[model samples]
Target chain A: MNDLTIIITLIAIGYIAGTWAEKRHYRSIEKREREFLDLPAITIKNVDIDDAKVKNAEIVYGGAVISVDYFKRILAGLRNIFGGSVKSYESLIDRARREALLRMKTMAPDATMIINVRIETSTIGRKSHKKSVACLEAFAYGTAIYLKG
Target chain B: MKYTARMPETNVNVTPTSPLREFFVLLSGVIAIIVGIYLLLGLALNIIVPRIPMTFERKLAGPFINSMASVDRSSEKAQTAQKLLDVIQKRYAKLPYTFTVYLQESPRINAVALPGGNIVVFSGLLEKIESENELAFILAHEMGHYVNRDHLKGVGRALVFIMISAMLLGPDSSAGNLLAQSLNVTEMAFSRNQETLADEFALNALHGTYGHVGGSADFFIKLSKEANTGLWGHYFSTHPENLKRIAHLKNYSRIHGFAEKLLRNIPAIINKKRPA
Candidate 1:
């Protein structure tokens, strides 16, 4: 009975707090995304540009770690039993990936564009041998090309 | 190609359906399945309990019951309790299985009717018995549970759950933990009706063995007085319920014309406290 009460309290906190944080994050992510819209982050390795015009090209990277709320974790655990799409985790991954990309764009504000962008997602939490907090890290890396006038 | 830099018309990656809505739906689905299994298990118990043979049950009870072997079975209090239980069993409650009484030195005033005819009599309850008739009634009550196989039904559901969890999900699955928590199984799982029937069985057995129903409700009467002191354990927690059972015992005695006779004195060993 005590355990159930604690679990329920955590889930309630997770739902209320997690949803609010997600909404605020998505709002900020969209505003910054629009601001950095012209500086496109593309996956293609090749780009048509003169070598002389490209004054500097270097790798820019951004990483974001998002911890799962108790509510979403419970929802995903339920989903695991039912064998279906884990919708609870979908927004988590989406937020982390987008946040990483936005941060990568913020790193190269003066660049012409970012190309050959790759986003790598990995879980760095809840391992048996380590005392780690539960969270997922999304790391985005790309080449930021600076064009000389 | 000119990159228009247009955000997609819609965020198709995430399904537009409300996550809370999905959460509720899936949560309900899980709850519904659990409730369904619980009901099915209840029905299955009705079909399964009586079919279980005494020998098989003794074998199944071997591991856990043996762990309790350290509790003295040859002591005077235990032997006396066993003798009374045997008399009740042989004369009135002719149940198939042989009952062994174990006396454990515990402050909890209770007797648990374990599977395979093992009645664990806590010294707390033994030290309080004022008469042999009361002890006989208590033993008969446990035997009554055996007669109706209520003991098996009481444990069958929980045993099946643990086994199912161990066999399907590993023992530590959160779902199992959640289900176990949700059920919140009490120490006493026998329903009120089952308890009333057991009381009736004990009343009849007392009348048959002792030629009277003199002390059928004596334990409850003693328990009711102590209930207000806040020291009584789970068995008598509900004072009103104990009163009701006392009334039921009297009414049943009157209806059956089983007269209250002179009470028999319990062996001196039962009333004496064991050395710590």
Candidate 2:
């Protein structure tokens, strides 16, 4: 096939598959976020809860690596040329960070809150030759504290 | 009831958001603006470059060409090249500028035209031609660039690109290097268009000189045979595919009635002694 045909096919596949995947993920994240609403994860470095009142406390963490779809990759490539914020990528990072925090909350179900939550993100799967970024990884970690009943 | 410790399952979210819509809209807008600017600049240059006096263009380009490549005048190959240039110059007597052809000893099969009326023909290109007609086609191609003032326009565009890049990237950064590289690819597409126009010039000039445009595409035919190594071999190249160029030359010759007078036998110039 010619170049135009190949490019059109890629864009079509990326749109259909990427849109479907993104929609499904958003739904799942929304549902779980509602369930985990009471489990607050704050970025504060210091915990104000009284030590004597705390019965159990443990470090909890969650991590994830998400691959970018072709549609977003193509858009990001265009953004690189024009030099601007790549909003598609921004959403990708957002989903990853939120998912990581949710997983950490799930780990300490008995805890009142998860304090000093930190989210760290980095890019992966970058080859020297390729123009588009492949995958991004986000890790969320925090201290889960349980109050004495 | 005793509490049981249970591991939490990791939940991975790979969801689409409204930002995807914004990404495509913004990207399309940016691409449209870039293309609009490119077209405007191209049109402006076409009108401005040809009107610049030949003497002024030569004065501006001559020193740069001299500094970039060493001219080889004493070699036997240079003498043969001079002979071909002399013939072409005589055939196109009413040219706007006096043509000065220089022979540069290089291994790459290429020729280039610099502003003013200077043409640099590489020794490697000279050694590959099977006839003086093929040589004439190459020289005429360069002459075509000279006639159309493409070299000066190219320089003008380069300066514009550099200035814009400097303003956008600042100095001494890796991002600046990437910007330069991307700009180079864009500039190459512009150069390819100029090459196509020059090819047309060469075709007409060859027909005028030899009564036929035969051998006008010999160099391109040779290059096409070596072009297919892989997908990326010639994809982003500045020159159009050699096969495409040859096809265009043939098409031009057919319409101009020059195809009927094609030479049947190869010229003896191919068997000339190599410069020691």
Candidate 3:
């Protein structure tokens, strides 16, 4: 096939597949997020609950690594040249952070609240040969609290 | 009564994981984009090069050639050089510009064709040539550069590379050197095609001048032997393998019946006299 046809087909596939996957992921995240509303996760420095009300507290953590789609990568590369915000990469990081937080919540399903929640992000699969970032790991850690009966 | 302050709070949202399938899709897309850009640039250059005028090319090459060392016209090697050049020039008398051959005093076995029909022949190459036919082949190959106007195309490409590098990497940037090195490699890649075309032109010219393609591959055959033991062998060298060129010449000669008129044991006529 001709170069133009091949390039067009690649771009089309990237756009359609990338958009569909992102939307599906967001929907799934939203449904899971609704289920975890009762177990509120917060980044506050300290919890206000009385010591008598706190039965037990333990550290809980969740981590995940997410890879960016080709469509988003191409957009990010173009943004590098023009010098502006890369919205696609922004979404990619957002998804990773949220996924990490959800996993942390899953670890303490019976806990009343998780406090001092922190998120750390790092890049993975960054080989010298590939120009773009392959994957990003997001780790979320917090102290889970169980209220006394 | 004192009012109680509400505690500062931060909300947490879950992010979805990216599937393995998406990574492959993105990688393939990026590869396609890179390939597309490379093809486009190649197509543009192929179309643009031939349109450039010869006068502009001469002006561009003039300074570079002037800075190189040249041999004195009174030298005995220069006299022999002129005789070989005269025969080639007579064959191509209809060339638009005046053709002149300059003998360089260097020991490097090389020849170069500059713009405005100026050809430079190294003393080492002259010493290594076994017969007049071999010298004629070398001269004709250089003439092929003039006919195809490859020098101009090379200069144009170099200027483009420099301009792009300067724009992307500032003048003092260390990356400028890297860019230049890559450009040199690309230039060498382009030379492979030009070299093949020049060889064809040389073969036809040799047949016309000597009534055969005899001794045409002698220089390349000798070089192939030396190339094997050389520090910078044909593997890393810019030009194609010498053995491949020799085989090509032999095949062409056989197919065209030029091998039938082969002249054997022709002694070197130019090296008989030494300069005073």
CA lDDT, every model vs. true structure: 0.84, 0.73, 0.71
Q: Rank the candidates by lDDT, best first.
A: 1, 2, 3
lDDT of 3 by residue, A1-149 (tens): 24435545666777788778877877787778878877888888786668999999999999988887666676666555546455567767777888899999999999988999999999999888866559999999999999988
**Per-model tally of clashing residue pairs:** 0, 3, 5
Instruction: At residue A78, give the lDDT of candidate 1.
Output: 82
The top-ranked prediction according to DockQ is 1
Would you give me the overall lDDT of model 3?
Answer: 0.71
Clash count, candidate 2: 3
Q: Name the candidate, 1 or 3, with the larger TM-score value.
A: 1
Model 1: residue A139 alpha-carbon error in angstroms: 5.5
Two-way DockQ contest, 2 vs 3, winner? 2
Model 3, retained fraction of real contacts? Answer: 0.00
Which residue pairs show collisions in model 1?
A: none
lDDT, candidate 1, equals 0.84
In candidate 2, the residue pairs with backbone N, CA or C atoms under 3 Å apart (3 or more residues apart, or in different chains) clash, namely A22-B15, A22-B16, B58-B116
> What is the Å distance of residue B136 in model 1 from its true position?
1.3
> TM-score, chain A, per candidate?
0.95, 0.92, 0.88
Task: List runs of model 1 lying over 4 Å from the truth.
Answer: A1-24, A40-71, A103-149, B1-10, B15-32, B164-190, B237-240
Lowest lDDT block of 10, candidate 1 chain A = A125-134
